[model samples]
Every structure is written in C-alpha cells, then in structure tokens.
Target: MTRTEELFLALRQQIVEGKIPHGHKISEPELANQFQVSRSTLRDALARLKSIGLLVSQPNVGYSVISLSTEHLMEIFYVREALEGMACRLAASNITQEQLQNLRDLLESHESSVQLKSGVAYIQEERDLDFHFVIVQASHNPMLIDLLCEKLYFLVRMYRYQFGMVSDRAKRAFFEHQHIVHALSVGDGELAEFLMRRHISASRDNVERNLLVNKGVIS
Candidate 1:
C-alpha cells in the first residue's frame, strides 16, 4: 500500500476501534509526525476518511471524528435491511455448495470462539463479516456490495460500541446467523430471507434500545 493508503487504513481502524472517540479533533501535524509522514500525505489520508463520513473537516479547525446519533443509526439500519435482505434472497438462489460449506465452517469457528468465553472482540466481528460477505458475493451484485461497503464503515464503528453494551449479544447474533445458514443450506430462499431480515431487525431494535437506555430515555 502507498503511505497515504496505509495511514488511511490505520486511522480508519483506530477510529472504528474507538481508539479515537467520536467528536475528537484530529490533529494533522501530530499525526504526520507520529506516522513520520509529510503533511501532504497525512492530509491525503484524512481526506479519504472525510469522504467516507468517518471524519468531518472544518475550514480552519481541522477534522474531527463523526459522532453516532439515533438518526444516523436509523438511516444505516434502514439501508442495511433493504440491501442485506436482497443479498440474502439472491444468495439463496446462487449460493454454491462450497460457499454453503464455508458459511458452516465460519459458524463452527464462531461457536468455538464464543464457547471459550473469548470476549467476542475480534473473532465475532471477523466471523460476522465473513458470513455476510459470503452472501453478498454470492449474490454477484457488484453495485450492492460497493454501496454496502460504504455504509458498513460507519455501521461497524457505531454498532461495535453498542454491541459491547449488550451482554452476550455477539453469541446471540451468531445463533441468528446459524439459522439463516441452515435455511440457505436447504435451498429455502423464503425462509433464509425471513430469518436474515428478522436478524437485522433485531439488531436495529437492540441498538436503539441501548441508546435510549444509556441516555435515560427508557427504563
């Protein structure tokens, strides 16, 4: 990767991982020095992140991490439901046996990781994306994947935080994934799509509930 690309990846990972909290100002000069890159290179990396809605740039004040809010969460989940629902439906028709086996393997690995009580930090996120990405690819829908990738950045950032708030939510999500996979394995498009939709809807509801509870808006 180019230096700028490398920097962009690092910064984006840090932001999503919560190493840099929302609304925190990002100092270009400091980052440039830290990464041992020139100001232009740092600016290029920051610009890429800005385009993705992860960072907002001010004329003179520099960039700050974008904050997650209820409105934003709703919008993200709405798009996810439509796009991911379609992906699941298409995957039901197009998924190969090998792909189905891969999905099963991911589920098995996820189950093992959770059984060890390994905190669901990296493994959960990795397996979750793996399962979904497999479905997305099976759909053979390039445009949908492109759009989903854009939205996924912010969704991952926001959901990861809220995910941590929900005890054992990752394991619950894994079980939901298993249901979808089982339906897919049987070539039941309707049931697979239904399960996938319900899974995403539940996640949206949980995220909204957590936000409200955290804000004292719900009992």
Candidate 2:
C-alpha cells in the first residue's frame, strides 16, 4: 500500500481499537510526526477515515474520533440487520463443515462464560462480534464482508465499548447466536436470516429503550 493508505490504516486501527479513545481531539502535528508524514498527507488520511465514520470533523475543533449516540447505535444496527441477516442467509448454504464446527465451539465457549456469570464484562461484546464476523465472512460475498467487517464492526465495537453490555443482553445474545448457528448448520437459509434480523432488531430496541430516549439521528 501507499504511504497514505498505510497512515490511514494505522490511524483507523488506533481509533477503532480505542487507543485514541472516542471524542478525543486528534492532533495533526503529533500524528504527522508519529506517522512520519507531512500535515497535508495526514489530513488526507484523516479525511478518508472520516468518510468511513471512524472520525468526525468539526468546524472549529478539527477532527476527533466519532462519539456514540443512541441514534448512531440505531443506524448501525439497522445496517447490520440488513447486511448480516443476508450474510447469515448466504452462510446457511455456503458455510462449510469446519465453519459449523467453529460456531459450535464458539457457542460452547459462550456457554461457559454464561455459567461463570461474567457476562457484563464487556469482553463478551468483543467475543460476540467475532462470532458475527465469522458468519459475515462465510457469506462469500466480498462487498458484503468488507462493509460489515471492515467498516460497520469498527463502529459497532466503539458503541459496545462505550455503552457497555449488561448480563441480560449478553445472555440473550448468546442464545440468539446459538439459534442462528443451528439454523445455518441445518442449511435453513430463511430461518437463519429471520433469526439474525430479529437478533439485531432486539439489540437495537434495547439500546433505544434504555440508552437513547428518542434522540433521532443528526444529519
């Protein structure tokens, strides 16, 4: 990759991985020096990250990591419902035996977590995301995988980390993922799609009810 793309990925990873932290102002001079690039090049990289929703640019404050809101959660889950639902559907037929085994193993791991009663640790959200990500990649659709894995998951991780996950949500998600996996293992595409959509919708509703309070999206 070119220097610009390399810088872009470096900064994007820092933001998504929470190294930079959300809502923290990005210092161009510092970043440029760190990346060993000029300010103009760093600005170009920042612009690309902004376009992908990993960064937000303001008039006077310059750029910072995008902060989470209930509205952003709603929109992110909406996209996930549509894209990941399709991904599960496609994975039903396309998912291989090895992939099915992996899902089963993942389910068992989650069951262990539930048994230990540590579901509120926020680590489950990361593990939960890994499960969804495997299925999304199993869809065998390049564009869909890229959209869900590379872009949406970054925002999803950010929101999950910031808002936190309760035990109730974690338990529900574990069971939901199990059902979706079972459907896919049986080659029931329609059922997998339905279950995935319902799972994501429930998550969205929970966030809206508990965290958002009718704050709609900002343009």
lDDT of each: 0.75, 0.80
Worst 10 residues of 1 by lDDT: 119-128
Candidate 1 structure quality by residue, lDDT tens digits, 72-91: 76888887787888888888
Cand. 1 Cα-lDDT: 0.75
Cα lDDT for residue 147, model 2?
A: 88
Q: Please provide TM-scores, in order, for all candidate models, with all chains considered together.
A: 0.83, 0.80
Question: On residues 87-201, what C-alpha lDDT tens digit does candidate 2 reach at each position?
Answer: 9999999998988898888777667774435656324445334788889878888999878877677778766655654535767777788899989989999999999999999
- lDDT at position 179, candidate 1: 88
Worst 10 residues of 2 by lDDT: 120-129
